[model samples]
Target: MSAVVDMPGAAHLVLADGVVHLDPEPAVLEAMLEGWALQQRTRFLNWESTIRPRIALVRRLTRFTNEYPWQWDPAEVEAFFDHLRTRRPGRPLAVSTARNYQNDLRLFFDYITDTRYGWPSMCNERFGRAPVQLLHEWNTITHTSEYEGAAERRPLAYDEVQTLFDAADGRVGEIRARRRKGSLAALRDAIVLKTVYAFGLRRQEACGLDLCDLRRNPRVADYGRFGAIFVRYGKASKGGPPKRRSVLTVPEMDWIVGVLDQYVSEVRPAFMPGKHPAFWITERRDRMSLRRLNEAFETARQAADLPPELDLHSLRHSYVTHLIEFGYPEKFVQDQVGHAYASTTAIYSHVSDEYRNRLLRRSLQARHGDLWGQET
Candidate 1:
């Protein structure tokens, strides 16, 4: 008889002569989970944002089922999710969140069950069973709708945009009047908010911008170095690096050129960030964080007294809507936001009723002209 040796700290049952022994140890299981997480980090660009929460979700599920991945079943998954729904009486998970959890579990199981990972093989050799996918299409939530986000989230109206900008600009004067020390920082925050809207940038993308990313557009020489923003950290696909795009300065928003030019020439240098590349910098001369960016927007929004539902992302939505209203092509708008699909771009667009009426009138006029020409 061959004896199985268990590592001291990482003890797990070993198969010998095709006979089953003890249960797999927690240490051995955790090591395998760590390897899976490492693989995910290697493959996904947004892994840093997701890994911790995903690992915690898995651990919670394990605790709920009182079993390891190899012992899990479809019934266990169903029960686990059911428990989640009722875990807090008034705080049930949102439909989209529940679906996301289901998808995350499927991906996790897919990795461990794959023969290349050796998780299934190791389990089968030791415990006479292997991990199988617990969540299936029938059991998971169906993606029946195109836009599953919160109903309250929406683009700001044109007047609301103006009010928000005014609030941001007013913060500078407010600080100065109060003889506060943060007046310069308030000006910087105002410009940052405008830049986010002007470029339709995500919070992280805006935070990631550097001074050098502002480029001169050959087609628009008047705008000079402020003609286009070279976005280096656009939203990424599932397992891809951050996308890149050049957002050209449009004629409607060309006023940003002067604002940026003045800031770069005078205001920014006051921060005394020697050789720092970040366009948005803190008083410490370090790069501005995403949290600070959100705080800036929230401050402005509250001052403007806009809807509570409106957040920093609403600026991006407003950019999409206003561009469509300005009669830019759908394809052009889609590229501006780095959306993988045109449909995703469409979801962001919420044009005004007046703009829709104008489009309808133009269509009718063109139809009438064609009819008159046919009669002739």
Candidate 2:
């Protein structure tokens, strides 16, 4: 029989007869998880980031249900999901997130119950029963829509974007005026928010930026080194390296040129990140974490009195919307954001009311003379 995708170690290898597992059941469970991880890594080429979370989710289910895989029932799986979704009165997991949890659990079941892997026989021999797939079509969440994110997560208005940036900058001033520490860090945060909107970058894409990723555009020499941004960590396809793209600086967003120049020349060196490739550095001379990036944007959002629903990622959404409003070609906007499909880029766009009104006016003016002048 195949050894769990033909991998060795962990689940694939059995303990010797003389070996003593003080906690035998737990040991077997851990071994199963490890074996599953190894199989995913070796056969599927999944990232550790993906494998670790799936393992944790399985463990969490085991804890919540107070049972091993062999003891689990569909009722318990349904109860677990109900508890997760209703834990907070007003909030629940996004459909995508809930589906991911179900999918991971299903994948785990697929691994443990497969006859070729021998997990069923191992469990049967030790515990008088075998593992079975817990998640079924009826018990699992379904993908009903293409975009199932919260409605709150939409594009910010132009004024709201400006207000957020102003708040970020004002934070730096507040630090300086109070003779406080972190003025440099605050300044970096301010520019980072601007760069996010200017480049239409995802969180990982922005965080993964290196100093060398800044490139000159031969077509737009006026902006010099800030003419384009090389996004090395664009969102990846499953089991694939991150997609790469170069976002050219459009004239509408070219204000980032001076802002980035000031940050690189005047502010970045203060972090003392010698030889560190990360463009955004922390005070401790390490690359900034995604948490810190979110915190900075949150601070500014609250200060600006923007809606609580707005988060750092709204800036990327704002970029797509603004580009559409600015009359850029749909294909150009799609390419700039590295979306595989124009439909995906279209999903990001939430154009403002005024832009739609302008389009309506233009259409009416073409059909009749002095249409706006004779309006009631």
Candidate 3:
């Protein structure tokens, strides 16, 4: 009779106490135990609370088990996977989401097989299943296998920006001087919107900035104004050698410093949750969280009569596009945006004419009158 065993240092199923124990190496056992522990810890945590947290944990588990070989009965695994596919609930799961779940399962059981327990060895050999092939079929059905396109999009046009700026300015002015103070909150809101749009900061990055991050300086220098800011890696990133604070350019520095001063001196001090590491605040004096910042952007978007779909991250996309339009190299833009791959940076290379026109002109110049009189 086969039974699962959890011995002092090793854990696996056995046919008897010592019926030829297989995969007895300590390193393998430890690795297997580690994978199990990860699963246990992940399961203990409440995954139902948030989808992001659940996805993150699932990814972590996937990474942990990716090294092991598939050990489960392939047919059993395939059946379970099919169940996951057919399981209906609220919203339909995206193809990407299903693939992610499959990846996690592959890692988990593969590690168990890599442990080389006799039962796993037997199970791996006996299981003849095509889960991976089925996953490919699912992908084909969902059309997710098509090349995921790049996201580099054009920024709002100059006219649009001007319109938004003028509208915000009027609102802020009214809020600042009004006797009834009906729209007095507009002053702080306008400052927030301008700083975000002008600087092209990530919503969280903008929300995360502290007063100390801004180096306020009155001096103007040759390389544009002399103020500076340190762009800290956001919470979404796992802190490591890759993550660090980067220096902002002059214009970005200026926007941040101006907002910092306004928030600190005029707006922040009056609010209860003002002037903390967070720069923006709500009318209730609460430090502006990213969620609040999103809401604020929506409110400002409506007030400015801008497109309803626009969000704060659009500011970052706009920033990258502006740089590209101004003829900055892909590498330079990538560095500014903290992207490691040029392909990732190229997402911002959408059909915005700023840089495209320059390249097109160069191409035309190279031809130089060759086709001037060609028949149509």
Candidate 4:
């Protein structure tokens, strides 16, 4: 009924359906064993069952860990991601449950190994076998498929971002009236959205602010010149340190502080929780929800008639694009946007060919002492 092979120093298991031989090729055998160990480590933690979403979270965490061999194998890594790529939000799964099945799998296989340890494992143990083959299938199928979301990144135009901001501002006003019946609440939301664009904060970072944190920052050389908002949580947190990050720019800092002062003086006390440690308060006066902030941002974008795909995160993209358009170097833009990878900033640099040529021609004119000719 089933094919079987035996080899020295090997074990075999036979079942009604077939026989499974552990006499794998040396490379295959080593990869399998390492994968097993990684799975066991993942299972012991029970992280997906307890902490994060079911699919690919363990793998994501493991990737964050500085482990080896488990982090190295291309096939094993891909297998772990296969589980992730197949996952759908709220779907039950024995392994990988990420929303974007293809992407999760791609990331996993792109970084696995066979000869190191000490870093945490990134594979989901619940998967009986790695789904590395699935990634191959995706690449094969999508090489000519009709699926979307595979498009290259392009920065939103300046007017598009402004319109989205305006939409967000209006919705904040509507929500404030419907929920809290307050004038200042809408104004606060406007200021919050503005700050997000100006400083390119992630939703969590913006919502994680505290009144005290915004009011006081240690990094400012001239505190009076710019507004200061603390970056509390996001991609930049190192070793899970709780130390705050501060962003300062003349008008933006003043805008946030001024709105906050009004909020604290007039609105905050009315909605104050008994003793919550957050700064951005809601109608009931608690720490703002990131989801709610995102929803509000969405509503605003729609109201402003912005493209449907523009999200709160696009503010960060827009910020980077603006910086690049103004001729800031990629490295400087990367630092301002808190990107460890310059490639991320590169996506926002889709400046038009016309714009690029204009700048180039202007540079030549300035060099040749014919600046007014180009200006004319």
Candidate 5:
């Protein structure tokens, strides 16, 4: 059967008759990749941001095997992952990340081998062999646990949070004391860090925030325009637009009202941001770069003597845990964080032992009401 139009497996004939080529093999491989990309775009309806990395991974696999898709052996898949697992001084691949890579690889091979793709026959005709799936359950990782994140990537202790803020503020003082540059930047960082925790935000979500996103909640008129965070760039599902959610300000974290107000009224204008809509502005008067955001956290983390693993994301984790400890309902916390599942919110929560002890005490008091405040 011939390939059809507007189908994922039918891009173009790779090895057409009388087509002279200096590199026939590479041409065939590229054709396969093009077909896969079209499939992802038209059939799967994936965004470029999602498809780009998966395509890059397939090319990376080609280099690892030095063999075409038809020639790829499952053993090569095992060897490749082994190389990745123990390769060099850097940390090994995260279990979740590795599992995703494996899933991507499996899907690529599945595409080529499927009867509808016409690739199996094409490859067999060209190279006397057909492509087959390299990845299998035996060779690939699985999602066995709910929380497979790094141990260090957890909610920071209350004291650690204070120390982090102090370090960021102290940086501003030090810069001004020395008559050095970047005092304003240091000040901006201190406030931004606190804002990030006050509203449970992912990196991109935080980056996407603007002045317009600051909306007033009628219930919390005391907070005025800072009563809620309108997250226009919440994390999305596969091949979907960014999710949107409005996180209402909780009384416990309402301290962020003053911090954000001061930043907008005083500190942000100092950046000379002319008509820039971004809540976090750079010295160049544009939206803050992710690199700069990372640097801001890293500088404070180092100064506070916090663990290297406690990156900016820890602030978000700290937020979830603190909200839980502060007697917020689980559903409210889940909605505030824009988590699609309660399980995901649970994973983010790393409530302190003291909080757990309080929970246990409350539980005991509920079951034994009359025993409370009595001599045993």
Candidate 6:
């Protein structure tokens, strides 16, 4: 047994046999690791999304090196990553994924080594060595580019988007023709896919919507009660609750008004949802889960014979691209998607070549009109 002696800035260890063990056992270090995680939470990082993954990465590093934080070195970091790369020879880790692992390790070490956190001093008093940063600029990946996502994750072309929607609608038709029991569910899935694309919502945001989130826009009275969606569960920044935004139903996507109106007035009530607030309900009268949302997108994508690489998030990308093509301002699109930076919205936009050519033609025509003092 050992006893911990708490001091002003450090903790000293005293063993049962009166011999001081400078380095504490790995099990004893769990408390300190947990404290570090808690400190991150206090700084406004989401517990489940940010802090948990950070702690998990640290634990992974520990397991790979069989060493505690104080004992770790840059060489161990390198070796651990090397092991990861070689472990799956056929499918080595992507550069972006590897970069994330390095960045997480860097942040964890930075926290532990900072004197303000008390971890370095505590480790020094107990182990005679303090935690050192194991990740450095020379060894770690540099974020030189704005986009690091997979090349395959891209916006759907206009035809591809139409095909996906048709497939979703076709599913409902197929079910109805057979008099299947799940036709209502199939139609619900179809509308969900369209809504995600129409509003450029993240999967979680879409799944987290409540019936009341839909509201009537005074200016767009013709759209009825489906004029806008108040997204209360927009993706949050580190340590913040979910962000909120109001996505107004634009004219180009007004077709969703009818679909949503029908769902709310007719289809949703059949689920026997008396008090459930979710806009999308299951047969069990529960809110749709993010997994279910993804499954719906997958079903539609496969039915349309689209690329396997395109996932539900691609719908958001398509929304951004199409909005840009429709001549909306960048800042408006940024706000619509709840992007903190316009650069993030740009990452999602993959405008079509035809749109670019159209823009070029418009510019040329305007120039010729000015030069000739007449219509070009």
Winning candidate number (lDDT) = 2
Q: Candidate 5: list runs displaced more than 4 Å.
A: 1-6, 13-18, 43-48, 369-376
Q: What TM-score does candidate 3 get on C-alpha atoms?
A: 0.60
List residue ranges in candidate 4 displaced over 4 A. Answer: 1-51, 54-156, 171-185, 215-226, 236-244, 250-257, 327-329, 352-358, 371-376
Report the error of model 2 at residue 290, Å. Answer: 0.9
* Candidate 3: tens digits of C-alpha lDDT, residues 146-196: 334222224566566667667766767666576556353566666777677
Candidate 4 local lDDT, 1-376, one digit each (tens): 1222332111121111243335422333344334443443444533332223323443453453433333333454455555554666754332222334445444334323211221122122322233232245534223332222324334567777667666666666676667865555555566667778777777878888776665444465444323466676756332233334556553323445555565667656766555887767887767888887887676677688876656777777777777777776788777766666787678555676767888988888788877556555
Query: Using alpha carbons, what is the TM-score of model 2?
Result: 0.94
In candidate 1, stretches whose alpha carbon ends up further than 4 angstroms from where it belongs are 1-24, 41-46, 63-66, 82-92, 124-129, 367-376
- Which is the better candidate, 4 or 6, if ranked by lDDT? 6
Counting clashing residue pairs in each candidate, in order, gives: 0, 0, 3, 20, 0, 4
TM-score of each: 0.85, 0.94, 0.60, 0.58, 0.93, 0.88
Higher-ranked by TM-score: 1 or 3: 1
- For model 3, the superposed segments whose C-alpha errors exceed 4 Å read 1-52, 55-154, 173-185, 216-226, 235-242, 250-261, 272-275, 283-286, 362-376
Report the error of model 5 at residue 324, Å: 0.6
Q: Which of 1 and 5 is the better model by TM-score?
A: 5
Which pairs clash in the backbone of model 1?
none
TM-score, cand. 1 vs. native:
0.85
* Alpha-carbon lDDT, every model: 0.84, 0.88, 0.54, 0.54, 0.86, 0.84
lDDT of 2 by residue, 1-376 (tens): 5544444433546444556787888888888887887777775555556988998999999999888988888899989999999999888778889999999899988888887777887788888999888888887877777798997889999888888999999999999999999899999999999999999999999999999999999988899999999999998887787899999999999899999999899899988889999999999889888999999999999999999998888999999999999999999999999999999999999998899999988888888866555857
Model 4 lDDT, full chain set: 0.54
